[model samples]
Target: MFAGCIDIGGTFTDLILYERGKGLEIMKSPTTPGEFERGFMDVLALAAKSRGLSLGDFLVKLELLVHGTTVSTNALVEGKVAAAGLLCNAGHPDILTLREAPRKRAFLTKIDYPEPYIPRKFTCEVRGRIDAMGNEIEPLVEADVVAAAKHLKTCNVAAVAVSLLWSIVNPKHELRVREILQEELPGIPVTLSHELNPVPREYRRTISTAINASLYPIVGAYVSKLDQALRAAGYKNELLIANCVGGMMPPDEIIARPIYSVMSGPTLAPIAAMQLTTDPNVIVVDMGGTTFDVSALRDRQLVITPEATFGMDMLGIPKIDVRSVGAGGGSIAWVDAGGLIKVGPQSAAAKPGPACYGKGGTEATVTDANVVLGIIDPDYFLGGQMKLDRAKAETAVERFAKKVRLGTVEAAYAIYTTSNHNMIGAVEDITVNEGIDPRDSYLVSGGGATACHIGEMAQILGIKRFMIPRFAAGLSAYGGLISDVRWEEAATLHETHVDFAVERTNALIDRLRARGRAFLDRAGFPRARQRFEYAYQGRYLYQSWDIEVPFTLPGDRLTEADVPRLAAAFHQMHERIYTIKDENDVVEFTTWKVRAVGDTGGADRRGVDLPKQQGAPSPKSRRKVYLGPKQGFLEIPVYQGDGLGSGARIDGPAIIEEPTTTILLLRGQSAVTDAHRNYLVELAG
Candidate 1:
């Protein structure tokens, strides 16, 4: 069976078709942001036409279809979400307004917090109450639900969010309110807190559910349109979507928990990085059109985080624990009012890409700097598919130089260096600052722009080995094909150390497992094919931050001894994370977590090896390329990446050109093709 994967980035939407025996074929199209489905269908049509097959014919042979999108992230960033109304408990109507007291640091003189997603007028209260013990203290009034629904209809809200107190313990009141609203308002979509996130910490859970509700209708409509268009075009494969947790899930499940895809765009590269390297430890540096994401991978797994803040709330979505910085190939470069040059927090998006792209963008960007400094060949970019206007780039760089009070080349170098520093800082934050030793790990660099800056970044971070995959530009789309179908279930049960009972914990785990199994069964996987992992949020008595400890439980049943064993796992994890642990202190289990994964097959299979290189290498041609400060405009050898074979060695400084990407090797480094034909770049110690 064939599989198709697509990833929509800020600049381009990529499509890859993989046949069981024929390997992979790829296509690229500019993303149409006005209507993303247009771009998506356009690329799918192109892929079908390339193989002389109809969409329906292709789908009949297709086993799966996976996609990664940046829509949710962009909507949140640009404030393009649907109008939403919030329904809170009777006494907590002003929860959104109060927020947290320490919105900004106390010492900051000027700090402006962004506005909340929902306005005061749209936030209404309902007469409902639930005690901390999960018992109903007050009944939900039907009149209140009808009134809230009518008020929301008058406000022209596209969706409604119902977040009542203690909904996690008992969703009875919330369910009744939802039923009343549906009967009253027939068409408006509603998001209940219990359905989205049945976790404690009332404020966080409430805000997260509200945000999900706000985006649900908009995202759901978009997905439906895209799916229908593809189906009409003759595609019938299961349309898989990428999640923020670095896994792929069916579109139905994704629609149910849209919060898991808020950072979908950035999570793909780390998974791709892991696939490209054999090293157990490495730092993944993914530099795309708009941002650079640096993350640490240990034992080939991307670090995961349970808490991440988006817009105005702490979303408890399981996500790749990546650290992001605003440095990219398209980052704008300009001089500020103080005569200091700065790289971006602002980007020139795809509409008017970079200044060198000759689209209407006049602002000098990192791409323009690279063009002016001779780091990039003007006529050879994108395999010459898109010719860059070198003169336009030079003019822009000269103008920026005049404004910044520096020479043309000097200004370009400064911008380049500063951008490198910014990325290096991100790497350090994930490594050195977090107590991870840089020497023990290799650096896996991908994304379209990473090849341009990998050498400098590796040098700054003192990392020795670097691996650049065959299709770095399309790595995320590649990752889509290789990830598993996974989901996480969590619950909060406050049990103090003195009162903790093993029986209670086992019962909670049993319930979660059943819930997980039900979800998997709906997705077409049986109980025998599923895998389970367990963890808990525990802390010392009276401690503020809790540590998440993972453990494996017996398949059929669990006993009392599992509690202390689980506690022991927590202590070990605490020591590993913080470098210290107090074994004498009592541990309190606050929350339990279980992750269920249905494997798609592992990636441990070997790759086809390339033939050994012959005696003498034929020089294609020599081009004047810039290496560094001392060696400016040196004539370097360029080789076609596809022509290189296994055991072939190319000494730097050189450039390896491919249809989709370019790899640059600096002086004092050498590139060797491994058994799999993947380039492994090693530097002198």
Candidate 2:
């Protein structure tokens, strides 16, 4: 049987078809913003046609159809979410506006502070009170709830969110309010914090509920349209969507809880990098049109962080620890008033695209720089399917040069160098700043723009080894195809180390695992293929911050012997994260968690070996290139990437050109292709 996976990104929509016991087929098409489903279906049709099969014939043998999309993230960035109304306890209608003090920064002078998603006019209050100890100080009056519902109906909001204080301890008030809203406003969506995120922080819970309500209408409509299109195309297999936690979930679940997918598009590529190679510790860098995402992996497992901030909320959700920066191929380039060159936090987007694409884009971009520097061949880009205009690129770059008092080629090359430095700095922020040594990690680079700068980044980070997969451009879609079904379950426990009981801790673990298992089982995973993990939120007795420590349970229970071992593990983790451990202080467990995963075994594709080469060919051509203070452009050799073979060595200055990407080897560097056809570049002293 065959399985299909699709990833819709900001610039391109990628598709992959995996046939068991055979191999994989891939295709790519520009993403259509007006109709994303149209682009998705078009790629599927192209993949079928490439294999000489009909859509119906291919669907008959398909076992699964997995997908990853950026709809939720884009909606939030563009301020295009649904009109939402918020219902809160009386006298606390302004809780969202009274955000914590730590969020405001005084140095930012470019833009004003962002406003809350829910406007003041839409915020309604009801008379109800709950104490921190889960005691009801005042009963939830039915009349108050009815009046709020009537007010929301008159506003004609697309969705409603209800957040009550201490809902995690006792959800009685939130539950009662949801029932009344549903009864009064039939067919309108209602979200409750108790159902979405049952936690202690009032502001965080309120923000998460409001975000869910804001995204409900948009995400629901997108998923519904895609589902109908897939069904009409004769696809009768299970549909799974990639979530921000680097796992797959049923489409129905994603439609109801889209808050889990805010970072879905970037998480998949890292998982694919881990699956493609045998490296235990590595950094995965995925650079797309609008941004670059860098994530670190240790022992082939994605780093999970519980304190991820999403859309103005400190959501305590388990997500892959990814750091994203506003730097990419299509990022705009310009000179500030101080004569300093700047690359973007803004993009030309796919509508006009980069100036080199000759699509009416007036702003200069990194892609245009590569074209002006002779690093990219205008006629050979995308196999000549899309032609670039080198003259237009030079003209755009010269405009910036006149303002900065540098040559056109020099200014363009500076933009390229600065952008690479920015990306390298992002990697350091996540690793070196966090006390991890960069030399110990291998670099995995993917996406259309990453291959262009990987060799330079590797040199700067002092890492010698790098790997680029066979279908590096479509790794995210491939990741969606191979992801396992998973979910996270968590609960808060207020017990201190001195008062903690071994039996109570074990019971909480058991309850969480049972809940996770039931969720996976309902998704069609059998008991034999299921796996469970146990973890705890630990901290010093008086400390406010907590760290997550993972351990395997002994037959669904924690024995007395497990306490000391767990404490030691927590100390080691604390030392790694904070660079110190306070063994004299009492350690306490604040929250318990369980993550259940189901394996979907599939055969791995064998990699193709590179051809043997006796000697490197002479330079096909020479072009002027800049290398830091080496002043004027230096002569560089150019070679086609497909012609290089195993053991083929090339010395800098050189450029490797491929149909989809280009690689530039700077001065004082050497490159060699490995058995799997991946380039490993080393900088010479």
Candidate 3:
């Protein structure tokens, strides 16, 4: 049998095919912007061609297929999401519009406030009231709900969201309103705040519902079409989609709440890095065509943020803390108004791509600059499947060179250095700013463009050790194939350590455990293959915000004696985060959570390791590359990566050309091939 994984990124679509005995094969195709499904089908066709089988025959042999897409995120970034209407409580209709506080700098006198996800003009208020204790203070007015539905119908809204005041406490009003809306506006999708996010915060719950409703129609139609196509191609099993919470879910489970798919593909990089090295502390950098994403695994554990910002709004969803910047292979380089060259916060994406691609793009990008400097071999790109136009690349860079009054080679060098600077800042934000030193962490490179710049990035950050996987180009897609099934369940339980209600908390945990177990069972995991993790969000008695504290409770219940242990853990964490601890203060717990994890057990890859061999590899050719202005162009040896065996060592300045990626070594850096044929770079002191 066989299994496969596909990831549709902004610039390329990557596919990885895994067979029982043949191991893995990866392929990539340029992403088709408005027709993402076309790019997806194209990759599958490539996989089929490689196997010398018809598309249908190839798909029929596969037992599983996992997908990751950027459709939902792209729609939100371009403001192309569906036009959705909001139904709010009469007195609190402005909850979505009111700003919590300015997110920008405090010293700025004038700042632009972000527009709400749903405009105020589309908001309709119905008479209803629910108190904090799950009590209905005022009766829900059905007539007003019907009137609001008619108003939304006249507006031709594609979807509707119901977010009433205190809906999490008493969802009766929200549920009733949904029924009336369904009856009046038939077939329109509706999202209830309580059903999606049953937490205490009013604005967070309300906005989360609005965003979900807005994404429902777009993501729903996309997955439906893809599912139908897969079925027609002879795929018999369920289609799994990657979620931003570092796991996968079926299309049916995620189509209703597509907000979880915003940053899906980037979350899997850390999981793949863990498998690439034995180091517990790893800094993963994914440099794709349009973006450079940085994520970390500390002590072999993923650091998940309860809330992450998308565009200008904060989403109340669990996400791996990934820091991204517009520094990639296709990042456009331009001269700023201050008469200085600057590399991107803007990208060429896939439609036009870089000038070297010969796709009608006129802008000079990072890839074009690399070509102009002779760093990238035009004839060897994509193993000669796609030839890069070096003359066009020089013409593109010359345009920027004239504006800056510099030579063409100097301008290209500037763009290269500027791009590296942007990527270095991103790594610092996730490492040094967070108190985790980069010098102690092993930097693992991913994406097609990673190997080109990682050595320079590592040198700049003072990192001593770095790793490049054998299949670094498609790390995220590979992660999807090996990832485990995971689901998290949470409940609101407000309690303090002073008079801890052991029984009540135990009951809440039991309910959460049941929910998690049911989900894992439905996902086809037996009890023996399943495990659970526990944690809670809490704060000091007088604190304004809460921090998540992971704990190990005794047995399946919490006793009075365990309260001090939990308190001590919270104090130590608080001191680590804020540099202070308060043992005298009471600890108040707000949200209890249980995360269920199931092993997939399909991680066998005997073909990945190479037989041990000894001998120095010879250079296939030599090319002149521009190192810097001081040392103009120098001849460097280039070796075919596939011909090199285990324990083979190569020193700088040299290039190792793999079929999918290329590695560059500077004057002081050297690389050695490990047992798995992965390159491990050694930096000079």
Candidate 4:
């Protein structure tokens, strides 16, 4: 049997296929945004050919396919989503039009907000009112719902989102509104706030629902088309999709809550680090063609991304905190207006690629800089599957060098260093700014460009060691190989420690667990393999913010004695981070969360090294590389990456060339191959 993972990135589509005893087979293809599903099918075809099996025969033996897609991401960023209408309580249609003020202390009128998802003409008010305590102040008027749905249908709205007052407390009216919408517009998708994100804050929940509903026609269609193709290919398996909440879900769940997939692709690299390494704490850096992202795992849990902006738009979804800087392999390098040199916040993506690719990209990018410096071989690029033009790279850098009064080699060095520093600053924001010392963390670098710069980035920050996997280009896809099916749910209790209701809290948790397990059972996981974790979001009395405290459930029930233990645990956590905690300050709970993971009890995937034992280091050939302006130039040898044996240590001023990546070790640095066929970079004392 076979299982695989596919990740669709901004520039590349990666595939990792795993079979027992045969190990992993990885491949990359250019991402075609015009038809993303076509790119996926193309990769699947390649995987079949590599195994010498026909497409139908290969899929016949496949049991599962896990996919991480950026469809919703591109839809939101490119402003290509479907037109949506909103149906809220009477007189509350203006809630979305009046967006939030700037996060500053005072409101500013000069700020500009993106065009609202639903215009005033498309928003309709229904005759229903529910109070904060789940009481129906005024009964629902069916005629009003019918009128609103009919009006929305006449407007040609593709989807509708139903959000009413106190809907999170009692969703009876919102549920009725959905039924009426289906009755009026039979095929149009409908989203209810309570079904998506049930919380007190209406604005965030409404935005989540609106975004999900708006993308249903687009993302939903693509998913359905892909599912149909898989079945037609003689495949019988579970097709799992990656969501923004750090887990994979079924096709039905994705269409219902597509907003959870906004930043899902970038989040997977961290998951790869979590499963690949034995360390409990690690930092994951992914440098792709267009962007570099930094994410951390303190105890194998993705650091919670605070609710904020998405694709320059004010949107909220449960996302992993992934800090990004526009420094990548294709980041453009140029001479600034002040007669200084600068690297990018701009990128030359796949279509026009980098200057070295001879794809009509005139700008000098980090990839171009590497080619100009002779670190990236023109003839051996991509294992000679594709060739690059060294002349084009030099010409692109020469233009910038002339404007900055420097030589081509000097200009290329500047571009490389500038991009590395840019990534360093991004790493600092996640580590130093968050009160965590970066030196205490192990670094794992992923993506194509990481091999060239991750070592230097870590060394500059006083870091001692870093590791890069052999298949760095497709690390996120490899992460999907080890990922399990996970689902999360949150409910608001808003209870003070002294007056909290333990029985009510227990009942709430029981409901959330049942809801989570139903899907796992449907997915074929037995009750023995299902596990759930419990956590609480708490705050000090009268405080504006809260912190999450995790606790183990004492057998399915939370007892009265557990309250004091929970209070003490919260205080200790607060004190450990903030240096002070008030025992007398009443603590309050805001939300309860449950995360359930259904284990697949998968294949034996714990091996460290490849089946082909690492052989002795063998040099392929030599190249004249510009080590630095200080050293001028050196005729150093380049080694074929696959020929290097484990425990083989190569000193600085050398290069290791692989099919998907390249590693450059500067003077005073060394590279060692671990037993796992990964490289560990160490700085000279």
Candidate 5:
């Protein structure tokens, strides 16, 4: 049986198919933005064609298919979501409106507050109260809920959100409200805060629930359509959707918690990166057609954020720490009003794509820059399947060059350099700012555009070593194959080392572990293949904010004996992050977390390597490529990457051309192939 994964990105839909004991086949197609389902089908068709099988026949031979989509993300960012109403406790109607202010602008003379995800008019206050410590302070008024439901029905809301005060502690009132709303507005989906986030911070919780509720109709229809399409195409197995926590969830789970699918595609890059190399501390850089994503792994473990934002608001869920910047092959190059050349945060996405695609785009993009500099072969793009227009690319660059008052080549170079700078800054934010030096970390480059700029970016950050996977263009899709079934469950706790609430902590962790295990069990993972990790989000006494500190107890339950050890772990982590720790000070634990993973039998397995060859390989062709202003354009040897065997070496001022990607070696740089045919580039110090 064959297993495959598909990732629908902003500019490209990547597909990777793997057959056990056979090999891997990868394909990429332009994304169909008007209907993402079409793009999904298009890539499957391409993969089917490559395998020389009918679409239905090929799908029937597959045992599994994992998908990572951007439908929820696109809907949230574009405000094209369903009309969802928010229901909160009486007198707290401003929970969504009075969002937290920017800390940097706290002392400003005037502050312009950002609008909430949901409009204030859609917010309805319900008569209910649940005080702290799981006590019902006031009885829930069912009349209020029914009235709100009728009002929302008149407003034509597709979904409703319930976020009463203290719902995380006592969810009876919230649950009752949901029941009442369902009776009043039949078939309308309702989201309860305690079930979605189940943590503190009202604004964050409410907004996250509201967002999830709003996305219900949109993501529900999307998943249903895709599932029906796959079933119609002759696939019979379960359809797993990638989630933000580096795991795949079933369609029903994703539709229930659509918020987890927001950054799902980018989250898989680190998973693929960790598998590509044995390095414990590694950084993965994925430069796709629309965004550059950076993620890091420490001790071969993913770094997950306790609270990550999807777009501008707090997601309030555990997420893999993948930072993304709008710098990619499709990033537009333009002259700003100040007469400065700026590369994008705005992309010529898939439709009009880069000007070189000859798709009616006139703006010069990063792809155009590479084309103008001869870094990308116009005729050989996509293995000559799709021809790029060199003249159109040059014309596009000339348009921007006139505004910047520089030659076409100079303008293109400026655009490329600026885009690289933006990518470097994003990498720094995740590494340097976190006290993890990029220089000491091994870099793995993925995505279609990464290989072209990895060497230069590595040199800029003083990184000595990096590798490009043989199938770098579809790395994220590849991740879905190796990724394990995973889920996270967390709950808020109030405990301190001084008091050491042992029984309470033990009870909380026990409940969390049970839930996590049940989740894996339901997903068909046996207990023998299940793994659980324990962590606590805490801070020093009197601190305003908290940090997550992972810890291990001596046994399944927490005891007073483990207090000193747990405190030490918190102190050590605190020192590592802030460069300061006070052992004497009390450490307070606020939230308890548990992560469960189900082994998939693919993560640790090594790929079959190609046979080694004795001598240096010959170049298939030569091209005039621009090295820089000083070196101008040099005739560089260009070799077909697939024709090169393992242990083959290519010297500086060369290009290794693959069907979907290109690797450029500048002056004083060289690359060697490993047993797996990966390009291991050694930067010149």
Candidate 6:
């Protein structure tokens, strides 16, 4: 079986061909910013062309195609999403306008807060009254709904979202609202908050639905177009898209709930590490051109956060917890107005890319610094397909060196170390701040730039073991191949144990599970190959956020025996996460989440078979490279990656150069390639 995967990154689109018997092969192509789908196809074509096969002929043997992209995230950041309309309660229609008041600048008179995506003019009201208990105090007036729909259509809204207060308790009014909008707007996408995220907080649910509505048309059209193109190209299976929670789902499911994939690209790095290594404690660092994405794999599970804020809009969805920093090869290096050197939260991004890319970028970036420091080979970058202009890089660094009053090499080293510490700080925020001991975890370097920085970052964080996969540059695409097809359905029925309705809760659980199973069945999963897992999203009394508690099935009802044990588990979990557990406090169940997973059989390859040999690998060449100010510049030996076969050992300071990435081992650190071509770096004991 063949599984094809593509990860559409900011600078490059990575393609992975996972041939069942032949292992995995990765290829990359520059991402076309305007028409992202073109870049997606371009990478796939390169992968096939390299193997002397046409795209159609290549895809015919594939079992599935999985893709991860930053399209939705880029759209939101650039304010390019389609116009949206919101329908809310008649008495209070300013849900989008009356946002929570948190100043753009704390304790300062800054009025730079952005306007809501949906203007007040585009927001209208409907006559409906559902109390907090989900009871219909006043019936939904059809006349008012029709008037709202007419107003939205007149405004030329691309999508309409309906979020009735307390809809989670009973979705009757919200469902009817969608029905009316469908009849009135025809093909226009409509989003219902209860169907998306049915939690207690009205603000998050409303915005989440509104955001979903805005993205539906854009994301849906992109997926549909890609699906059609793939089908025509001879791909016989469904095109699966990675989701917000670090799993693959049918693109149709993503279209229905676009909010579930808000930061889909960043989530895949950690998942890729999860699939490659069996270690329960690992940090996956994807250092691409524009950003450094850091995520942790703990206890064999992807750590997820319930609430994440994006551009002033708080999302109430469970998503992979990945911390991102503006620290990458393309992160611009500049002297701030305060006369201090800063790396970035701003980047040169992909287009003109880094100064060394020789694509007309004049700005000094981390990539330019690497070129100046001789950490990268200008002639060997991108397998020499695109040559790096060493003079351009030198000129870019010299400009910054003038500002800092330092030598060219000194300034370049400054940029490199500055960016390295910035990434270290970011990793600390996710691990140290969360009570995770950095020393207990290993680092798995990913992305095109990841291997370049992994050695230093791991050393600074006190991480002992570090490994970079041979196919690290396209790790996300490889992960997509090994992932399972998953579907999740959640419904809110907020009630404490005091008011717990066992039969009603069990019925709700079964309903969500059925929906999940039905979705899997439609996707062609056999009943035997499918299994349903359950969880309870809960929070303590008066708490704003909730935590997931694994649901253990106990017959069809909540027995008296289950309550204390469940409560104890919640207490233990809270203690572990928050460091505070109150056994006496009232614990409430907010939502019932049912997950359906279809097993797609996959096997991690055994280390490559190399003729058993001993002794260290030979260096292809020698070059002068600048370490930090402490070590200064030193002459180091560089080895071609392909020449160093499996079980090859090379001690520091040595440079292992691959077409896509380079691994730098400092003094005393030794790198040993395993049978699978994985570089496992060991620290000096």
Candidate 4: stretches off by over 4 Å: 97-114, 141-143, 306-308, 311-314, 334-342, 572-580, 606-618
Q: Candidate 3: where is the Cα deviation over 4 Å?
A: 106-109, 605-607
Pairs of colliding residues, candidate 6: 607-676, 608-675
Please state the error at residue 87 of candidate 3 in Å: 1.7
Q: How accurate is candidate 2 locally (lDDT)?
A: 0.79
Q: Write the per-residue lDDT of candidate 1 for residues 526-634, one digit (tens) a residue.
A: 6676887777788888886676766688764556656677668778878867888888788888888777777765352223556787764555777877665787678
**For every model shown, what is its TM-score relative to the native structure?**
0.94, 0.92, 0.96, 0.93, 0.96, 0.95
The lDDT values for all models are: 0.77, 0.79, 0.85, 0.81, 0.86, 0.82
Off by over 4 Å in 2: 103-106, 109-113, 277-280, 310-316, 602-639, 642-651
Model 6 lDDT on a 0 to 1 scale: 0.82
Query: Over the stretch 75-101, how does candidate 5's per-residue lDDT look in tens digits?
Result: 877889999999988898886666664
- Residue pairs clashing in model 4 are none
lDDT of 4 by residue, 1-685 (tens): 7888899876778888888766776777877778888888778888898889998898888777889988887798778999999988888887776655426325555666656666889888888789989999998988999998889888999999888888878889999888888988998889999878876766777777788888888889989998998888876888998877677888887877788777778888888888767777788999988889899997776777536465434565557788888888988987677877778878887768888889798999999999988888888877787799999999999988888888889999889989999999989988887788889888898998888887678778877777788778888888777777878887777787788789999999998888888878876789998989887878799886677777889798988988888888789767745668999989898878887888754335433464443555667888888867778779987888877667887777788987888988777777887766687877766
**Candidate 1 has what TM-score?**
0.94
Taking the tens digit of each residue's C-alpha lDDT, what string does model 3 give over 1-685?
7787898876889987788876777789889999888899899889889889998998888788888888888887788999999998888777776735526545876656778878888899888698888899989999999988888898889999998887766789999998888899999999998887777777778888888899999999999999998888877876788888777877887898898788788888887787778898899998899899999987787877765776667776657888889998999998778987788879998979999999998999999998988888999997778899999999999998998888999999999989998999999988888787899999888888888788778888998789887778888887788777777787788899988899999999998899889988888889999888898888999787778888996688898999998889899878856779999999999888888877775456423666665667899999999988888999999989888888888888888988778888888888888876788988644
5: Cα error in model 2, Å: 2.8
Q: Lowest-lDDT window of 10 residues in candidate 2?
A: 600-609
Distance from true location, Cα of 103 in model 3, Å: 2.3
- Which candidate achieves the best lDDT against the true structure? 5
Can you write out model 2's per-residue Cα lDDT over 1-685, one digit (the tens) per residue? Answer: 7787888876778777787655676677778886898888888887777768897777767788888888988887777889999999989988777655334346756655557668878898888788888899999887988988888888889999999888877889999898898899988899998778765667767877888888888888998999898889898878888888888888888888888877887788888887767788888888877788888887676787766665444544557888888788888887778877888878876768888878798788888887887777888776566788998899888887888888898888887887888789889978997899888988888777787777778887888777765466677777777778878777777665556688877777788889999989988899998988777888888786778788778778877877777788888879978999987778888778888887765325434566786687556677766655555567788877767778888877788766566677766777778775566666655
| Residue 12 alpha-carbon offset, candidate 2, angstroms | 1.4
What pairs collide in candidate 1?
Answer: 55-234, 56-234
